[model samples]
Every structure is written in structure tokens, then in C-alpha cells.
Target: MSLVDLIARADERGLAASGLACLDRCVPLLGGDDEVLRPLWSSLADGGADGDAWGERLAKARAELDCADPSADTVPGFGPDPAPGSGSGAETETEAETEAAVSDEDRAAALARRMLATAPGDPGASALRAWADACSAAALQIHRLLDVAADGDGPLVAAERRRQVAVLELLAGRGAGGLRPALEVSTEGRRVLRAVVSRRARGRS
Candidate 1:
């Protein structure tokens, strides 16, 4: 199935794999200004966007899909273009052409870390900053958790660690909002880690 198809397969099924597939498709589709991915891409919740509230975020992403700027409040969803009811291969091709406009990314990850490309480090980068803070704390907590739980080799601990790493990756490359429940590598794993991080961060400050 196409990457989009994989994403829409079923929210509870293959969420991580679907996200990876979507990313794979994005490699060739990003960087340009087509604005086609605006609806689908924005809907993803990198990591910080908790699962409970993700649907609202997805809606905003889809609504603002036409906006090209990431900070502009648009994050696209992976929903079928022309909306499941377009009724024609030709329309799909047209949508493809429309999405094809954005072909190259000029961001830090895609480029050579030239600038703070994902989002500015300034306070205005609210989404990026919130997620960043969440992820950073999550990472440290998860690491400590792993070290303490190393001898246990418990599947639960392993699963939690995996989730933390995935969240970190999502924040690092795609910002905190790209990690949709649909894109989650470990489902609720990162969330548990996020709580641990919150307590630790509170203790520190």
C-alpha cells in the first residue's frame, strides 16, 4: 500500500510503521512549497502532543495545511487527498502534482545544521520549545530508568525506553508536534516517560 494508505490503515494498527512510511515518502516530497502536505503532515504529533488531545491538534494541522511555514500553525494530516470522495485517478494525479511542488528541504536536518532550522530557539517558538523541554526531560529520565532497570531486562522497561527514544527523535527532527499517536513507535511508552520527566524537571527547578 502507498504510505498514505498505510497511515490511514487503522489508528491502533501499525502506527509507528505507518509514520515511518510517511516519513520515507516525505523525503522526496518535502522542502518545496507545494503546500500539499500541509494538511496531512501537520496532523502528526512529534512526541509532546499527548494522545488524548491529539485529534484537536490534527484538525488544526489539516485546517492550516495550506500554510507553508511550520510555526504558522499548520500541520498536515495523512488523510487521502481530494478527500476519499474525489472519485478519479486523474484527480489523485492532480493532487500529486500539487503536492510535488515542494521537493527540497532547507532545514538544519536536511542541510548541514547551518541554523536552528527546525524552529527558532526564541520564546516565540512555543510549540518547539514546549516539546523540546518535554523531550529533554523525558530523555534524561528514561536514561536513568534504563540504567536502574538494566539488570531487570523487563519488557516493560525496554518498551518505555523505546518510546522515549522515539519521542526524542520526533522532537529532534520533526519538532514536538509531529509525533501523532498514529506515528508513535511505542504508543503509550513515551507518555509514561514524559511523566517521569515532569517530576524530575519540577524537582530541578
Candidate 2:
């Protein structure tokens, strides 16, 4: 089934996992360490019996990532492009392009941070579904922005899509048992994103 269909059919746990997986992979952009989200994952594994656990863990995660205030950040929009001749000469144009690229990366990171910041503390099914859908979009956009190759979808984007699909499929077919393997898929994606982030940082140096 398509990723959309899978998400629509998913239960609360599946939706939570789906959204968390997306955010987890993008954690590199937030300067988060690998284990930062483990508490949330463990809460899901336990079926969220203790509702307070999820909320407390979420608060801790937010504090650690320093994304505690969602309202402080503005959601980005596709504003009009700069007018022609905004910069003159070839060197000026190159600098402009580089600045644009960095701006895109900054926007991408902001999107990822927004995903985390806006995640509901006591997520109901409706909230989880919305978050999952938004995370999917933000994660894909993050990969696309960071992808050095401007080719259609790019390898990074294509792999991210596949991983999202695989995660949902695993949850659909295996239930809670799928969380481990789904997490594994997310881990691989996280590594890829970290490398990309590191490469870009080195390039900027």
C-alpha cells in the first residue's frame, strides 16, 4: 500500500511510531544524540499504559533539544524568489547561490525542530495522525534540501521515502513486534542524515 494509505489505516501506536521514526531520523539537525528519543520509543513499546510516562518523556526530550517553545518559531512558506540582478557579477552570484543554499538548510532544520516542538504531550489518535502526516512531509523536505544532488527526488529523498514505507509496512504486518525493526530502519536513516549534516558542515568550513 502507498505510504498515505498505510498511515490512514494505522492505529494510534502505529501512527506514533511513524511520526517518531521520522523525527528520530531528523534529530541530527536538532543537534540531538542518538538516545535522546529512546524514552518516547520505550513508552510506545510498553503500549503507553502509563500515560504520564509519554508526557514526561516528551517534556524531557523537548528540554534536551531546546525546542520547548514552538510558538517562538515561525513556519516557513515559499516566499517569492529574489528579483533578477539582486546581485551583480559572477562572484556575487555564486555567493548569493551559496547563501540561498544555507538558508534552505536552516529552513529544513527549523521544520524538523517544529515537528518535535509541536508533538502533542498527550497525543490522541487525531493529534498523532496529524503529526505523522506533517512529519512525513517535513522529513522528506529536509532530505531534499540537504541532498547535494539536485536531481529529481535525489538518492537521499528516495531512500527516506522507502524507509517511511518500510516502517509503516512493518507495523501493519507485525504489530508491536515490528517496532524493533522499524527502529532499525530509522537508525540507518539517522546515520545517513548525520553524515549528510556533517558533510555540509565541513563544506561550509
Candidate 3:
């Protein structure tokens, strides 16, 4: 089923997980460790997104990511290490590299913060629906921003859509156990994003 269809059928908890999982997968782009969002995942165990546990876990994630500042939308340093003998002029290159890193980090942090903001604990249908829609848009936007391909309408977006669908389907078919498979798919996407960053960095060099 399509992502839209899967989301429509998903309960409140499923919807939250779907969105959270997407953000969690992209943590790599923000220089976050793989297990950073694991606490949030644990809260979803009982098909619930409410109570102190969710809030505490969310706060921990924000702290761990050093994203405690809601206004912290800056992207940290990203891209490949500078190559030797590139002769791009070290001083100028350093300034350019700094700009690139900040830009990427700012954008990435903003996207992740937005995703976190959308998380609602056991929301009603209306709230859940709105959150789901936001998640879809955010997920697509996140992919677009991180994508190395210049074309706005490119294969990257298509692939992200497919992955979203696959994640939702896995949730539908396997319930709680689906989180593992869905996360695996997300890990693959993270690798792709990392590669894109490396490629862009190489091009700059």
C-alpha cells in the first residue's frame, strides 16, 4: 500500500512511530549517533505516545543531540575531509568549508527539530492526521535538502517515497516488530545521504 493509505489506516501510535522513525534515520545527517533516538522508540512499545515517559525520552533525545535550543536550527560541520594537494587555496577553502558545514548543519537541525515538534502523544484522529501529513512533507523536504542530486524532481525523491511506503507496510504487517525492519530500511537511506555528502565534498575539492 502507498504511504498515504498506510498512514490513514494506522493508529495514533503507529503514526507517531512512522514519523519518529523517519527523523531517527536521518540523524546521521545531523552528525548524531545511530542510537540517539532509541529512547523515543522504547516509549512506543505499548502503542502509546503519551505520559511522562515520552516527554522524558524526548527531552533526553534533544539533549543528547544538543538540540535543546528550539531556535538551534544551524547545521554542524558535514561533508568529506579535505583532500591533500587539492591546491584550492587553504584559507579560502577553509572559509568555504566552514560555510558549507554550517549551512548543512543548520538545515539538518531545523528539519530534525521540526520533526520532533510534530510528535504528539496519543493524539486524536484530527491531530494524528495533521501530524502524519506534516511528517510526509517533512520527510520529503528533508530528503530534498540532503540529496546531492541537483534536480528538484529526481530519483532521490522517488526513492524516499518508496522507502516511506515500505516502512508503513512493514508496520502494518508486523506491528511492533516492524520497527526493526523499518529502521533497517532507514539505515540504508542514511548511508545514501552520507555518500551524497561525501560526493558533494569531493566535487568541491
Q: Can you tell me which runs of candidate 2 are displaced by over 4 Å?
A: 76-102
Which portions of model 3 show Cα errors greater than 4 Å? Answer: 69-109, 121-125
Of 2 and 3, the candidate ranking higher by TM-score: 2
RMSD of 2: 4.9
Q: Residues 1-205, candidate 2: write the lDDT tens digits.
A: 8999999999888888999999999999889999999999999898751388988898899999998885544544433455687756885666566656656668888889999888888888898899899999989989988887766798999999999999999988998999999999999999999998999889889
- Sliding window of 10 residues with minimal summed lDDT for model 2: 72-81
lDDT of 3 by residue, 48-161 (tens): 566578777877777777666544333344334556765568765785767675664466656667666555544566676677677677767777776656868477677888
Please list the Cα RMSD from the true structure of every candidate, rounded to 1 decimal place: 18.2, 4.9, 9.1
Q: How would you order the candidates by lDDT, starting with the best?
A: 2, 3, 1
Q: Backbone clash tally for model 3?
A: 5
TM-score of each: 0.22, 0.86, 0.72
- Residue 51 displacement in candidate 1 (angstroms): 19
- Which of the two, 1 or 2, has more lDDT? 2
Scanning candidate 3 in windows of ten residues, the lowest lDDT window is 70-79
TM-score of 3: 0.72
